[model samples]
Target: MKILVCISKVPDTTAKIAFKDNNTSYDTNGVQFIINPYDEWYALVRALEIKESQGGSVTVINVGGAENDPTIRKALAIGADDAVRVNTLASDALNTAQNIADYAKKEGFDMVFCGKETIDYNGSQVGGMIAALMDMPYISYASKMNIVESKATIERDIQGGKEVLEVEVPFVLSAAKGMAEARIPNMRGIMAARTKPLNVIEPSNTDYMTEIVGYELPPAKGECRFVDAENPEELIELLRNEAKII
Candidate 1:
């Protein structure tokens, strides 16, 4: 099985987010980046597990500038056979998916995987877009999968309960939580990753279909107010009129 896992670089959750150019873009200065948690913990690790059990090669692909190489290296250390970095900073989800889909098509990978969403944007659109561009079956939020002889049975969450579905070899999946456990890179893996193949390729398409208007942080928490515990009706009024919960 030839598998391709899509990875992304995201600002560390603890990093203080700020906007630049009048709040039109993210300010990356002094921000530490890491492989998106969903990508690393579920998508990439599950891909590695599949490869280990099925005796196939796993390749991780990223769409970003040269600065993304460090995150790509981290993916390699987690047990990917090789990595591909599309040398382009994608402005939107479409172009990012387009670049990845183009590469997956050229490589003819049997399976394509991605995290359900990126922490920074949380769009949860790239995987579906890639599946569309490649014209393959797409399964999102895949939690568990069992593969045998070019067929796979995948489990995912539905509206109220879990849903299990089956797909053939050539398909796309966006991994969610419970797909797999996260793996830490040991000294040996880190050393091997330094020599692992990090293939850099130019993006096939650079046209962006979307633009960022602006970004703003969520409103800060308001001051806490107290109501007399002995007066239940007053609390009800507060909830109904002030907090609006009722």
Candidate 2:
């Protein structure tokens, strides 16, 4: 079995987000990037576990520039057998999915894994896009997954209950929490990662339809205006006028 795990590089949670170039772009200056937690903690680790159990290979793929190499290497250290870096800086979800789908097609991977969503963008579109591009089955927001006799059993969280579905090989799954545990690369793993093959490939020619035009932080919170708890009319008026809910 050949499992391909798609990893994304995102801003660290602690990094303050800002924009530049007339607010049309993210301010990358002095920004810290990390492996997207969902990808690293659930998707990649689950792929690794599958490989260990089933005797297969796990390869990590990333669509980004040179700066993404560190997080890619960290995934390698956490047990990905190898990695492919598509040399591009395109952050649009559709373009990134295209890049990964193009590579997956050429590689003939049996299974593909990605995070439920990136923390920064939260688009949650790439996995389905990749599956559609590859003409394969797509299962999203999976909290648990198992493969048996070339069929995949996936469990995903829904509004009030979990949904379980089964699909055959050559499918895509976007992993969420409860899929697997996060791993920290130990000294040995880190040293071994240095020797692991890190293949950099030029991205396939594809047009990006989406672009970041501008960004802004949400407005700050206002002071709370407490009302008498026993007054139902006041609450109704507050909801109808101040909160605008009713």
In candidate 1, which residue ranges exceed 4 Å CA deviation?
227-237
Q: Write the per-residue lDDT of candidate 2 for residues 38-76, one digit (tens) a residue.
A: 999999999999999988999999998888888899998
Backbone collisions counted per model: 0, 0
> How much RMSD separates candidate 2 from the native structure?
2.5
Q: Name the TM-score of candidate 1.
A: 0.94
- What lDDT tens digits, residue by residue, belong to model 1 across residues 190-244? 9999999999999999899998899998999888887777887898898899889
- Assess the local accuracy of residue 53 in candidate 2 as a C-alpha lDDT between 0 and 100: 93
Runs in model 2 deviating more than 4 A are 224-246
